[model samples]
Target: MTGSTVGGQLAEELQEIRERSGLSLAALASRTPYSKSSWERYLNGKKPVPRQAVDALCALTGTSAGRLLALWELADAEWSGRARPVSAPKEPQVPDRPAPSPAPPTAAARAGVRWWTVAAAVAGVTAACLAVLAFVGGSPDEQARTATEPPVRNHGCRADTCEGKSAVAMGCGAAGMITTLATHTASDGRRLELRHAKLCHAVWVRATGLMPGDRVELSLPAGRTQSVTAEGSLDAGRYLATPMASGDSRTSTRICLDVPDRHPECFTG
Candidate 1:
């Protein structure tokens, strides 16, 4: 089967394990070193599952890693196309000649020695390939131990220094920008800024002066929209949305604060 097919199967198995464990994606993320978003991608087969992640899941679900690792091996082999064996080249034919009388070791003996050397070289290469495969497959216990370790954080920016920086600049991804497209004030006097990051190719809404129960919604082109509610009475929050398509020509994006009869606000570029 193709690598993608195998990967999808693996993803399904992981999803099933998560469901059987009665853990939500967020809960799974909390138990593991991955974030909820990372789990989403993995379960959906949108990204390759890491060995560490597999170990984490197996540990969390009390499942043996043998079966899962076998599936992963199949998928990985297919994806890398390295499972296919290479055929050795055929030896060139030589014309038949009368056998020479037995003599001291000569050029032919040297050629035989060289052929043995080539054979040894091929064996070494094959051994190296096996070693690589074994390493890539990894040990279940090692992976489980790694999963128990704390998640690594980006040292470039902490919560205090993340503001005003593009997600990529903050180590999120390669595609990101810190430029603001426009800014507007909601009817409730809350400031809303339309920010665009080129690398992410997506737009974000930053709202300040928000209350604990306030709800913010973003309306984008092609009828796409997303909404989030404020938490813990934070005065400022940022929400990122799906990547904007290149064909979208809307001059402005809309934001609505859901309060008792408050109108939506627009931030024009």
Candidate 2:
């Protein structure tokens, strides 16, 4: 099938799964990392569905991702056709100089002009050499400082500590330190913890008292967010956000559960 046809088929399948799962657009958005408008575009084929979004939908509906991914590969291949070769820059044409004076100039005047021209050429060359030296040498202290600096230390638990441990348990929370930034309870009485680790410099939310298929979403200021769904009758789930810098005062964190008729709970860091 053509790439567009394959993409259309993929979109149709995604919509079918969502409908079969009996979740509204808002509910899907609440349970997944994507926004409602993004879901709309993906379903209608107005935009390319991201791989992560595809995986999330498959997980939510208990559908296998293999077929969807194959369609995506075809669509992506069509979207990214062979790159066109770049053309080389055209060379500049030098304008012809006026012919030398029909009558020869005086010897003294010619000598003076030649001297000035040589001086200007030397000055230009010297300036270029100085610029190169400045770039290559920098400041001695700056060079020494860089040379003597130690390698950056890796954060979070390593070796046995991380074995069989959940991401949060291994000190991979926001900022790389397992600090609880806030807590909230969902309308359904599930407890949630907003965690930050200094080393990872990212935020995540953990929800407890969940049931099968329950989902949790954590949104942070500046449009960072994550979502995860419960599996296998588990009572807990966690959603992790992208990495961020530590100690930003401008952003707030929010958490929401996909339970019906519930609003998001928010806290400022």
Candidate 3:
């Protein structure tokens, strides 16, 4: 099957199973770790569905593993099928034969690692250097660089970024920090809506070029900010400021900030 066809079919089957189980999208999501929007994407084939997700759905709805596994195979085939196709069928059947243990990492994976990993390591080194520079009385140039640099947004705060406090207020905190300040002008000169995130402490937003009626939404986890409402005539050049936090932790303090597009220097700084 084509990618779209298999994806669409899997989505349909998933939806069918959900309905048969009498589970709302949110309720089904609650049963599993996947989010409601993620389930929607799986059902609509907006994104590739993970095998674990399929397994979770089967476990939740008490669906037949054989059938669900078949659907998963179909979806996997759409992306992996070759000119002649391999013996791996559209639906994987657990045969009577026992499975072999998996092999170690391939030479390629070990060779260079991944570009993203390298980039992340580099960013970490850079952040550490900046933190050191910040701790010590750094020069004006160094301070400016640190101030202008974009924040490295880390997804899992559990141990690395968080203190691992089991309490909800301490552990389940979210925050969005500022990494860079940019200058932009609105075409036709209209006020842009300011947005931010609220983790533990309420976010403090200070922005220019924003008039009344502008709306803001705080994105948790990733702490992405988006504008929802707008008012007043937007000006060409304006400055905006927002103070946000997820409450300070022993391991993690500030949330990683996103580097806006067209700000490579900011990221490097």
Candidate 4:
């Protein structure tokens, strides 16, 4: 695919994620190291999104980052296409100067002198070229590729490597994290989910509209469980996360949210 097409598609996805996240470019800039103008260019397809920016946006939105990072890989490959050779620069022409006056000489002498002049000119040009090559150290095409090459991506770990960790923080969300497997909405409008981080071989709980004293939990077989409590009221749209636990689709995983004075609500996936 063309770089523009790939970049535009990635940009559209990022813009959608940003809008859903309710974070402004300035917020994104502040949250990450990127500048506001950089985020603007990234969302507008004026440039390819770097791996760091993609991961940062996904973490900010509490969204799975795998799909976006995959899209970014494609865009970067297109943008950093094969480098072309840099053509030699043409030397500027100088007006011919009058030949210096010389005494008349034999025909053989004139030929030898002319041959010597040509040899010296060739040697001078060759030496100058060697000096340039020594200074440059590498081909222009190599330098161009180095300049435009994409940054290395670390997609986080898989399976055991991701067990009991924050998917967003460890970059699992940027790779093999999956969509919500099960969802539950509480009587008070709080929402909970059993999320499958497939690459992580684990599951976790995420809840929104949490109130102070709200407790969220993710449980697996053999009594392994992890939970989190809201210390204070949280924004309705902000998600509260629990530490992950080892589990997969083959096994049932349950997520629950318990509010004070209310019965615990739970769902299994």
Report the alpha-carbon TM-score of model 2 versus the true structure: 0.33
- Encode model 1's per-residue lDDT on 133-190: one tens digit a residue: 5987765444443443233332223332433333322332221234567777766577
The lDDT of each candidate is 0.59, 0.58, 0.45, 0.70
TM-score of each: 0.33, 0.33, 0.30, 0.44
- Tens-digit lDDT track of model 3 for 56-165: 67755645456776777666655343223323222324467543757656788654555556666667777977788678877644454344322323222232233222
RMSD of each: 16.7, 18.8, 24.1, 16.5
**Where does candidate 1 stray beyond 4 Å?**
1-4, 84-269
Query: How do these models rank on lDDT, best leading?
Result: 4, 1, 2, 3
Compare candidates 1 and 3 on lDDT and give the better one: 1
Off by over 4 Å in 2: 1-4, 82-269
Candidate 4 Cα lDDT to native: 0.70
Candidate 1 lDDT: 0.59
lDDT of 4 by residue, 1-269 (tens): 22358778998888999998899988776555467898899898887677767876876687777678788776766676532343344434648876566755689987787677667777777798678868988754455445654333343455665556665545444433466787888777888877776656767787888887888888888888888888754333567788667777777777777888988888777
Cα misplacement distance, residue 98 of candidate 2 (Å): 44
Least accurate 10 contiguous residues by lDDT in model 3:
260-269
Q: What is the lDDT of residue 25 in candidate 1?
A: 87
True lDDT of residue 159, candidate 2: 31
lDDT of 4 at 262: 80
